[model samples]
Target chain A: MEHTWDFAAILANWRVLWVGLQGTLIVFAATVTLGLGGGLLVGVCRYAKTPLLRLPSMAFVEVFRNTPVLVQIIWFYYAFPILTGIEVNPFLAAVLGISLNTMAFSAEIYRAGIQSIEPGQWEAGRALGMAYQQTLRRIILPVAIKRILPALTNRGIEVFKMSTLASVVAYVETLNQAKLIADLNFNPIESYTAVALIFFAVLYPAVQGTYILERMLRKSE
Target chain B: MEWNFWAVMTDFDLLLLGLVNTLKVTALALLFGVPLGLCLAVLRLSGARLVSAAAAFIIEFFRTTPPLVQLFWFFFALPILIDVRMTPFIASIVTFSIQSSAFFAEIFRGGIQSIDQGQWEGGKAIGMTYAQSMRRIVLPQAVKRMIPAFMERSIELLKTTTLVSTVAYTDLMFQANDLAQKTFRPLEVYTVVALMYFALIFALSQLSIAVEHRLAKSGDSTVR
Candidate 1:
């Protein structure tokens, strides 16, 4: 018995897939913004020696880092509306969930970056009579950003891939769309192979760019 | 606000069973992944360009894509391609093992490369073949160096086991979702599940840190 592969079913679903791809990009963009913004705050807390700032931040990072993103997304989507009297659609819920998860990871990366800066740099800032916050903004942050860019970019890519978990919560991302197309056409091979290649096309360059950036940074150092 | 923990947990046994399934799959995936990954790592460093290139491509392909997509492909497409049906549990295990192997292979490669070049030279000086050197001289040390990372990877695998629930594999997350739907207590059910996961991962991570410290201490002793 010979079975021929037909991509006709998959090709027909291109419009749905395009919408799903837009959903994926939108979620990725939103989460990256929210995650990085929140991560900076959390990372600052991590840099603080006070238990007030550090303890809660540490707990937040550990809790998010340790749990599955799927569980987090699902939990957040279902739990958010219940806990708060407000209702959120799946897209918003997923964005919040992924952002918090990404925030934890990003904070950890940022903490590592902050810690990597020589202590003398801090003292040097102090000797210049810079306010603590100013010193952090002016001196520590620039160096930390430079030091952490590669690792941070890698984590960003993880967030990009992980955004696919939104599909499980009924958000129609690329994977969700592909699953739909496959289920409809009963043709998983063509549908998913196309999905995989699309992902590869998007992610490969980012991965390569990280390597390149890291090398360039190292050479300068 | 009335929090009925009891109400949500009415199907406690199902949840417990799910927890058991989660651990069972995690352990199974780890057992399958680590050794296979070690081989893949060695194969990549075997000085055979074609073999190494194939391994690299496969690893990159697996790494770049989300595991959820891979799981879906294995669950759905593989049966069609092979003309053999696999249970969701089997598909989950197979997918996780393949995915972890790619990650672990990279970790093994990094650990191996980080070893001092002098170690390899010393092995060669001792009239040992490359395989013998890796097995006898290099691997033991690399394994030790890689243990903390191995633990981290295992923890990641454990967390990833939650994905099986999406395929209705009866993992802890599946049970919690089931409980949530049954009781109309999504918040309560998932909270409990999340707490359980947090405690388990936290404890394991602390243990990893302790083991890492011990490994570092032992390395220092050999210096003395």
Candidate 2:
């Protein structure tokens, strides 16, 4: 028996790869939007030290942050349907699981960013007869956003990378699609290597761009 | 679909196997990855431009890429390329060590760079080699300061070991998924697994906090 590299087999499945790329991107974008918004609410609640709100949000963050998303995806894929009697496709389930998983980490990031603002800013806002809401809206948010923009961007890149985990639930993301094609043609090296490179290409620039943005922001300060 | 606590308990052996595998992988990865990553950090700080550039490239490339995909590539492709048949466990170790090493390399570099320049010059005044100075002066302080960050990375690595199940290595996630599929009691089975993970990681984070408090009490802020 003779074996050789067979990239052409994978190349023939370009449309699947393209669709997989779109799937990955769609999940990434959805997680980013939902996770960041949820994280902001959780972060604010926890940071403001509201006992009832803070305790549950903190618990949510701790649980989600600790567990692997692979289990979360599986649980949501199977358990959610059983619990709710609502069947979701792999894509939707992966998105929900990953969003919740990422939301916890993002909430922590948001908390740090929120706390980076000095307490004096809050005092001054109160001195101006503004509500806590107004102070957060006008002052804390702006500074925190400036400080944590790069961090949030970094997390966005991570969420994109994490989308690969969706492959486990039989989601037709790039890695799973590549695996199907690879197994078909017995071109694991070429197929998987190309998949890795595809991820690298999508993710590398985003990470480096964040670095440059952070440095520039630091300089301007 | 029914929640059966006893069913999950009966299958706890499988879950425990997965848990053991996960811990084994994590401990091995940290044991190897930390030192390898430290070397990578030193390479990145090498006097030669190309050495540092190569180190930086490897670190950034792995850091940005997906570890799960890397695991897939190594598990499926490496045997074909290298003409060696390795177990899924070995493949996971290979993939994770490389990936975690990249992450730890960055952490190590951060720890190293935070050491004051005057300390390095002081080492020069004592006519100590870079290696000796690092052994005696820089590393002791840096490693202490890095304890919290190291524990955080360890927790990340532990969470990451769950991915080993994807390669059919029967890690906790895999076993839970397997149990769910076989028993049709996914809600009950997966809930147990998730809680186990929560307990383990929460304990680790608490330990990290305790270590941080001890560091503060000792007044061992390294920069001084």
Every model's DockQ:
0.71, 0.69
How large is the interface RMSD of each prediction? 1.3, 2.2
Show the lowest summed lDDT stretch of 10 residues, model 1 chain B. B215-224
lDDT of 2 by residue, A44-96 (tens): 98876568888988889988988888778888988888889998899988999
Q: Give all candidates' CA lDDT scores.
A: 0.87, 0.87
CA displacement after TM-score superposition, residue B161 of candidate 1 (Å): 1.3
Categorize the docking of model 2.
Answer: medium
What lDDT score is found at residue B167 in candidate 2?
Answer: 86
Return the number of clashes found in candidate 1.
0
Q: List, residue by residue over B1-224, the lDDT tens digit for candidate 1.
A: 46789875567888888889999999888888888898889888879899999888888888898888888888877887787778988999899999999999998998888788999999999899988989888888777788888888899899888889878899999988888998888888999899889888889999998888888787821211
> Residue B99 of model 1: what lDDT?
91
Candidate with best DockQ: 1
